[model samples]
Target: MIKAVFIDFYGTVVYEDGEVIQKVSQEIFVSGKVNDKSEIGSYWWNEFQTAFNNAYGDSFKAQRILEYKSLEKTIKHFKSSADAVKLSNLMFRHWIEPPIFEESKQFFELCPVPIYVLSNIDRADVLQAIKYHGLKPAGVFTSEDAKSYKPRKELFEFALNNVGLSAGEVLHIGDSLSSDIKGASSVGINAIWVNRNNREIPSGVTAVKNLIEIFDTKYFLHE
Candidate 1:
């Protein structure tokens, strides 16, 4: 029996910062000699992920700091004159005010189990977003709180301890395969993938196209 649900905040419960990232990337691309705008986006994401992967344990850095550092590298790589700090600030603002999905509101209203946010974002950003959207989750956990990001067991373990539930007692749902699915599974917790983009589902993994699909009797138990 599932006692609670652990859901991811950005890209899962609400819109991601893709638009703001695109806007920033476009500004950089326009200033730089890059031929393809997509290249800027790809490079920025790759840089951020590399930074994120390296951040853990004694080397832990807040997501905001990582974003700033990654943006600086991206700017330098493209030879763009844009200020990394300014662009990173824009991304932070968007993270704090991302639009909640309509179906998410419906899921919140109907989900029988208590829902807690288990995200890889900064604590303040996710908290502000929860307030901005008028959400009342059972609790919110973030990388800042655990001093480690997702795909690392520390964050998930921290969340489980706070929620007072064993790994098998809760279900974690999120959009990222590596972060949410792999992370949760690593700790013996069941997870559902919110594959909104119709990506190919891997074997033995359960998936849904949207939040509403979570209510399917096969995946969720009302009890």
Candidate 2:
């Protein structure tokens, strides 16, 4: 039986408004120069992934730092405004808090099991999000706490260890197919992907569309 639920933060509990950033960033920079916002987004994501992966072993780069570096690079590389650093600083301030999902708020209230947030965010920002949303989970764990990130079993193990529960006793739920589902499974935890975008349910992986679906008696309780 599952004793606790571990959920991801960003895409699961809260959703980031990327469009807001895109519009604002473009306004701050040269729109004529940065023709495709999606292109810049993809480039920023690639830089973040590279930094995150490189920091896995010993180096520890905070999410905010990565954001600054990525945004800085994107701005300069595109030959936008000369004030790239200033623009990114403005963006980073806005990036700290994300809007909480309505379904996630309801899940926190309705779920019978103890729930915790396990995310790959810096400690301060994670705590800020929790407070801003008024979330009262059993606990909050982040990359800052683990000194590593998701898609790595070590972080999953850290959450399991902190909860003092065996992998079998906990259920991990998140939006990422690779990080949440695979990482939790790597340590024997049952995981469900929160596929809100109607993605295909890959073989060997269980999924739910909304957070409430898992609580549906007819759908998941029988399992």
**lDDT by residue for model 1 (100-204), tens:** 887998898889899999988899899999999888898999998888999999989999999889999989999999999999999999999999999999998
Error of 2 at 151 (Å): 1.3
Model 2 C-alpha lDDT per residue in residues 112-163, reported as the tens digit of each score: 8889889887878778878888889999888878878898887888888999
Minimum summed lDDT over a 10-residue window in model 2 is located at 23-32
Every model's TM-score:
0.96, 0.88
With a 3 Å backbone cut-off (N, CA, C), the pairs that clash in candidate 2 are none
| Among all candidates shown, the one with the greatest TM-score | 1
Clashing pairs in 1: none
